[model samples]
Target: MKNALLIATACLLGLLSTTGASLPYPILPPLFVNGAPDSLTHFLGLPPKLLFALALMVNPIGLLLGTAVLGSLSDRYGRRPLLLVTAVGAAIGHVLTAWALASRSYPLFLVARFGTGLLEGHSAIVRAMLADRLQGPLRNHALSWLNGALHLGWLVGPLLAGFTIAWGLTIPFYIAAGALLLGAALVGFALERKPRAAGPSWWSVARERHAFNLLRHDGLRALFGVQLAYTCGVTAFYEFYPLWLVEVGHYDTRAIALVNVGMCGLMTCSALFAGRASRTEPMRRAAWLAACVALAIGSLGVGHLWVGLVGIMAFGLPHAFYNAVVQAWAADRFGGGHGQGAVMGLLSTTFCLANILMAAAGAVLTLVDTRLVLLTGAILTAWAANRMRAWGSGAMAGLPPAA
Candidate 1:
């Protein structure tokens, strides 16, 4: 019963964290546009393009710093305390963001987003916690469920935002804040504390050779590269997909949200299926290659409305499978090590860096052609897929086969 409760709490944390992270996506572009009455560009007195990019940039920067700092801290202190602190801090950040939006204060809003990113390292901690508690197939299954919870949150957040955004642009932030507080309460009460002897400080962890040594292994390096490339592709696709819809399909906010719902829904189902599928490492690698091909095809097809919709769904479905498989692979490698937090932190940092670059690139690419940006993502993803074939075969030499 206690184990079940812990798993349930972790899943809930995943849901809340992802929902909070995704809520702003459907609403932010319109709010940051030039000459949109009472928008961030108008209030901040900045160019529309610059303000839009900065809005995307700040959050990921905060996330990179926070994950790099806090993931190691969770190892030194304890997961329970770190989880509680970050959750409450995130809630506060959300409240402040809502206030900033209400007052039309651009600087305050930037600060709020940065703070939120710093505190949102909870996802890494949650994964580390689950990895600590479960082993082998059980761990993979639990993580898959957590992934499902995340996509479910993504599905709900945009739908909720689409509905409530009609009421007020800032309304979604307030609702997200409430969910974070609730998540804090759940973590405070449900998660059992397991303290260890103090581990190395964040700086010490960085200086240590053990964490760095893992990268010397060819398979691990490839896995990390795959994650980076995948994130780059995903960030590019999502950052511009809404704009594409508006420009090419003549869709409204609600329609975009509906499209997101379908995509996320497919992603959720794919993750759930991955949890049950009896997949070997080679098979998983093959599927990842196939997914990259689908993403490329879908991205290239985005010029047509129905074709683009199908492409987005195709991109989403394989994404869930690849994420679960790679994460499980990483957890297998890092399990029972002092560097779990550090390694996860590095992974989070990589993801954040990818997002930061893609966001900036997407903004600039809009100047050229929107479809070209997605095609660029397709090319990157395809390259990563081809690399994985060599890396997967080489990495499997000594590692135990997937159960």
Candidate 2:
């Protein structure tokens, strides 16, 4: 029963975190458009595209810093306390975001987003909590379910945002804030704090030096490399897909939301399936590679609306598989040892770094040609697939069996 409660808490928190994070995607484009009644350009005296890109960039920067600091804190202080604190911070951030939007303050909006990112750095903490409680196949399965919950939030968030955005731009923000607070309540009430053996100082374990050690392990290095490349591809694709739909496919916000729903729905299903199938490590790796290939093909072929939709679906389905498998792999590799929070924090930082780089590249490329972003994504994904294939040949020799 206790284990079940922990799993439930992880899933709920995952859903809340993802939903709040995704709410802005569908709503921001309209607000960022030049001459739109609610546009930020008049207030900020910056081009809409530049402002949009900066807005996207700031969150990840905050997340990078927050994950590093807060993740380590969780390792030292305790996951439960950190979870409670961050969840409250996230709620406050969202409230501030809503106020910023309501008052039409661009700078305040950016600050709020940064705060949200800082607080939402609970991913590593949550993963650590699960890793601490569950083991072996059960742990893998729980991670998969956690991944699914995230996608489920993504599937629902944009649709809700799109529909409610008509009521008021601030409405979605308020709703998200409320939901986050509710999640905080759930965590505080439901997740029991487990005592942990004292470990190394967070500062000692949280250093960049430790991240280098992950590369010393042959299997871990390959896995990390694959994940980095894959993240670059995914960040480019997801960040710019809305722009692509608007500019190239002529999709309105509602249409984009619908498409996102479909894609996220597929991704959620794929994550659940991958989680169940993860017992077969070889098969999971193969599926991951295949998914990358599909991402490349679909991304490269997205010229028209129908083709873009198909490409989106193709990429989205396998995207979850890659995430689920990689997360399970990471947990299996590092969860048993001391400083699991720090290691997971480092992993989260790597992904965020990739996101920051790819998102910046995509934003710049969007000015010249949106298709360039997709094409670049395709190439990167294909490279990741190739790397995975090579890594699979002998990488498993030193690695433990997948939990």
Candidate 3:
């Protein structure tokens, strides 16, 4: 019962992290168009384009910092305390962001976002916590559910942001802030504590041979590369997709929000399915991953909104399967005390670096046709598939055949 509670609480907190971060974003286009020259231009001391780029860049960097630091701290101190800290801090950040938005304070908004990122460590932290407590099927299942919560938040947040911002652009932040408080309460009361020794510090972990050694392992390296590629691809879509819909497809904000709902909805459904599927077969893992890469690549090549929706559905469906399979495989490969924390941190760093590059690239590509960006993603996905195949074949050679 206690273990179940911890997992449930973790899932809730995970949902809070993603949904809260995304709330301000779905409304960003409307906000940018309507409020930007008035609210952000002079405050940011950069062109609107440059400010948007900076904002996008900072979000993932903050997440990267949060996961790297907090995941490690959770390893050292235990999940409960940091969970508490993050929840409370996130609540504060959200409320402050709402006020900042009302005041049209860009610097304050950036500060709020940075703080939110620091407190937003719930996803990575909970993932490590589950790794500590569960194994095999249960662990994979938990991760899937965790991802589902993220997608669920994704599904609802944009639409909510769209509608709520009608009242005030800053209003969505208050709603998001309320969710964080509720999440904090859920976590504080339900989560059980299990403290362990502090693992290596970030620099110490970086210096360690095994930490570096994990990257050298052919299979893990391929998995890590795939992770990087997919992250870049996803960030590309997230950063540019709505803009493409507006500019090329001529869709309004409501239309774009609806499309986002479809994509996030499919992703949420896929996570639930993948959670169940991961325990049964590992090669199923590779197949789902391949499917994800293909769909994500294909989505960009299509132009019409209906056709594009089909591609978007394809793009989202295999995400959690690929994620669970890859992470499960990594956990199985690197099983030890604090090894999960280290692996997660490295993965977080890689994805963040990918996000930064993709955002920069996406910003540039928006000046061109977004379709070309998708083709570049497709090529990388193909490269990742070949690498995963080689890595899988080599790594599986010694192990018993999949059941």
Candidate 4:
């Protein structure tokens, strides 16, 4: 019963948090490019495209720091308290974002997004919680549940934002804020209060025990490199496609949301399926999946919008399979010794770093051509696939020397 409750709460929190986080996705591109000029969108005479990149980059910057620190904090301090506080704090961040949108203040928007991203890392906390209580296959299953919930939220968030945006531009953020507060309340109710182990001072913990601490382990070094390269590809695809839609596909907010609906809906289904499916040769599977994603995305370079949309929608299944198998491999290999929180946090850190790198590079690339971003994603993922194939063959030629 306790396990059931925890999983349920985890799913709920995943849904709410992802929905809140994704609310601005369908909104931001149009707001920057096509929405009526305002102080926020037209800030300091910078091009809207550059400002949009800044908008996308800031939150993930905070997420990088927060995911690194917050996960380790839960390891020492306890999960329930930190999770609840961060949920509430993220809710506050959403309110500030809504205000920034209303007042047309780009600086305030950036600050609010950074703060929100910093506080909104409780999803990682919940993953650590799952890893803490569950072991072996059960842990993998629980992660699938969370993955499904998150992808469903991805679908729901854009739909809600797209459909209701005409009501008011800020309504989606307000709704997101409300949903987060409700998630906080649910976290307080469903999660049990666990006694924290006695540990060093909080500041000391923050200083010493970050997600990067896991890098000392030699076995994970290659894994880290592969994941980072792959995530660079993934993040590039994620951050740029909407811009692709805006500039090349000639899509507006609602159409982009609808397109995301197809992608995310399929992703939600695929993640659940991948979680339960048995598979062999995990590394090979990851390689194949990455290759498929690369091939599909490579079609974008064909310069036909409809062809690219087919590739985009086709992306979800293989990507979900890759995520499920790779994450399970990490937990199975590394979870027993290293703390799950630290392990998961490091994975998350890689993701954030990828987002940062891709977004910054994309800002420059968008200035050149949006297709350049998509092509870069294809190239990186293909390279990662080759590396993973080599890793599986024990060549380990170019990777961290297996040390």
Candidate 5:
């Protein structure tokens, strides 16, 4: 029953995570960019994209805060309730987003995005539920599917939006809302399980020595540290790649989407192998290979369009692999209720921190030169790979290395 619930929840999560939060970038930008009244400004009579950017920043802010609080809450209240709540919240948020779009209300739309962000369903309840349900190879397998779901969600979002735009933007929100509500229903009815235990208190979850103990548990730190560095590079590329293609490589939105398709394809293909690798001696080898692949892939951008596309493909495969490996590894280390919640929250926090740093560097690089940023990312990735290799070696020193 527990394993069944976990698998079911994973499917629901895959659907819920596919909502159009990230999709708006690819679709809505064209709406606003081509002299259409910026929806926010036209609807709300707001000043400009600057203030909107300030207010809309709440999306990611809410995401980070929501995931942190919800992760803890899931531990305390149990995964089922929190899952239902966030799913409902996401559903409501999307409905509101649709209404806001229809009514042409920028302020209201911002509120909807903030609400959507607050659900934080991906990292909190979904990951917690997975940790609660699965074990060993099965657990790793489940995470690989989840990793693929993440990319699948991202891939479909924009493609779906692009197609749905012919009908109107508001329709996508309605579709997203339906997905969320259905996900809620899946957890409510399909899981049919009791709460595991009382989760850890917020204050208690914070004390690192008691819970995390990375010094004693060096493997966990190595996993999370890889996440930190990997996210840094990935975020940098996501921020600048489109612009780099446009300015340096001379590609359009259609071309960009095609490139994204390649990325998604590589990631999906690599996730399964990564899951299998996590079970044995090849774990460390896989990580090193993935990181090196990312470095090499990222470096390919130093040349031309085809070269860069190959690089992106290479980078995406290793990245997708690492994501599953790290998450599975973290869950192995801290699979208990509150501990799982705390680990999920910490992972998201690390991702956000890395993204922030990367974004700052990206902004500066744009002023300096875009190619410089890509080159820097390649160098940083290589350096990070070396660090990870060292960490993995140290972790393996005590145990008979797996084969």
Candidate 6:
């Protein structure tokens, strides 16, 4: 029961943070491409696509940096303190984002987004807490719930923005900001810190044992290298699919939100089933799932209405399963002795880096056509699938050697 409560809290935090962070997905592009020109969208006379890409890139860059250290910090200082501190900072970031939007200050909005992403390392922190408590299938199940919560947040954030942007562009941001504070309160009151001996300062620990340290291992290096490519595919789809709708189907904010509901809703359901089949090797399953997801995502660039609908919705199944399989595999194989916070942080850092790479590349590709970006994602994921299968036989046979 206690474990259940903690997992629930972690899921809720994932929901809150992701929802707030993804608010701009359906809203921002239209603001740049279709809405009245403004200081934010037209900064320094750059094209709207470039400006929008910069906005998207800044946050993930911060996330990449923050995860590098925050996970190690939690391992030294305790999860509760790190969670509480970061939540408040992220909430403030939302408020700043709202203010920037209201004032048409693009520079400030970018700064706020970066700050929010930097402090939003709480996802890794919460996952680390679960890793500390649960093992094997229980931990895998809990991570699935957390994964579902994040997908649901992606659905809700755009849904909320789609509905409330009519009232004001900044309204959804304010609502998300308030929700973040509530999440912070929940953390402060509902969760208890596990007692641990404080060994060294967080900075010292962070400096020595950062997120990328795991990459020093040959097996883990190949694992994360595969993950980097896989995540690039995922981020490209997540960040640009709405834009794809806008360009191909002439989708408005409301229409884009409704479409996301279909896809992200499926993802939420699929997450429940993640890693449930114990007989299948996780790496093998992950390879199959990635191949399926690549096909689904690749099909969407064709622009047929039926193809778009089915492709968007069906891709969720394999994406969710793939995420769960990889995370659990990483935990079971590499999480011993090394802090789970650090391991989880490595995953988070890799994801943020993937996001940054895709966003930047997608911007340049979007200038020609969004289909090119989608195709690039599909190709990378297919390559990753093949690579993962190659490594599966050896990795499935044995546990990771010590760091």
Estimate TM-scores for all models: 0.89, 0.89, 0.86, 0.96, 0.80, 0.95
Evaluated at residue 355, the lDDT of candidate 1 is 71
Error of 4 at 62 (Å): 0.9
| Model 2 lDDT per residue over 1-403, tens place | 3888998898888888878777877776655652364545555465677677777777777777777666667767788888988888988998998898888888898899999988887887887777777888788788888888888887777887888988987888788888888888888789666777687775765564344455666556666666677677777776777777777666666777998898888888887877655345552475465556446445544577677777777776667777767776667666556366766776676767776777788668767777887778677776777666555554455554433
lDDT (10s digit) by residue, model 5, range 1-403 = 6676677577557645654455554544334323367566455564343333333355565575676566666666677777887788888888888888788777787788777877844565677677766677887888777777777766666566656666887877788788778888887886665646665664564343122343245445555566667666666676556656666666544556667677777776777566775334345654576566557546645767777777776776777777776677667655563377767766765665555566556556655566666776666666567665655555545433222
Estimate candidate 4's alpha-carbon lDDT, on a 0 to 1 scale: 0.84
Q: What is the C-alpha lDDT profile of model 1 across 1-403, one tens digit per residue? A: 2668878998898888878777777667655542365655665465665666677778887887777656667767778898999998988898888898888778898899899988986777887777777877888888888888888887787787888988887888888888888888888889766656766665775355323345666545655676677677777776667767766876666777898899889888887766654446643564464456446444544588778877877766777877677677677665556456666676777777777887788678766676776877777677667656545555445543433
Query: Candidate 1 — what's its lDDT?
Result: 0.73
Candidate 3 lDDT, 48-107, residue by residue in tens: 545665666666767767765666656566677878888888888888888777787888
lDDT of model number 3: 0.68
Best model per lDDT: 6
Every candidate's lDDT: 0.73, 0.73, 0.68, 0.84, 0.63, 0.86
Q: Please, what are the lDDT tens digits per residue for candidate 6 over residues 1-403? A: 3987899899999999789878889998788888777788898889998888888899899899889889888888888889999998999998999999999999999999999999987788988888888977789999988999988998999999999999998899899888999999999887886777858766778789888888887777777888899889888888888888887888899998998888889999989888474677677778898999889889878978678778888988889888888888788777786789999999999999999999999889999988888889888999889877767655433434222
Q: After superposition, how far is residue 261 of candidate 6 from its true place, in Å?
A: 0.7
- The number of residue pairs in model 2 that clash at the backbone is 0
Give residue 164's lDDT in candidate 3 (0 to 100).
Answer: 76
RMSD of each: 3.2, 3.2, 3.6, 1.9, 4.6, 2.3
Candidate closer to the true structure by TM-score (higher is better), 2 or 5: 2
Instruction: Rank by lDDT, highest first.
Output: 6, 4, 2, 1, 3, 5
Candidate 4 per-residue lDDT, tens place, 1-403, comes to: 3888888888888888778767788899888989888899999989999999889889889888888888888888988998899899989999999999988999999999999989877767888888889877778888887888877887888888999999998888889999889988988888778777887988898789888888877667778888888988888887778878888778888998999899988999998877764645778778899999898778887878899899889988898888888877777777668877778888888888888888898889888888888899889999999988878766876443221
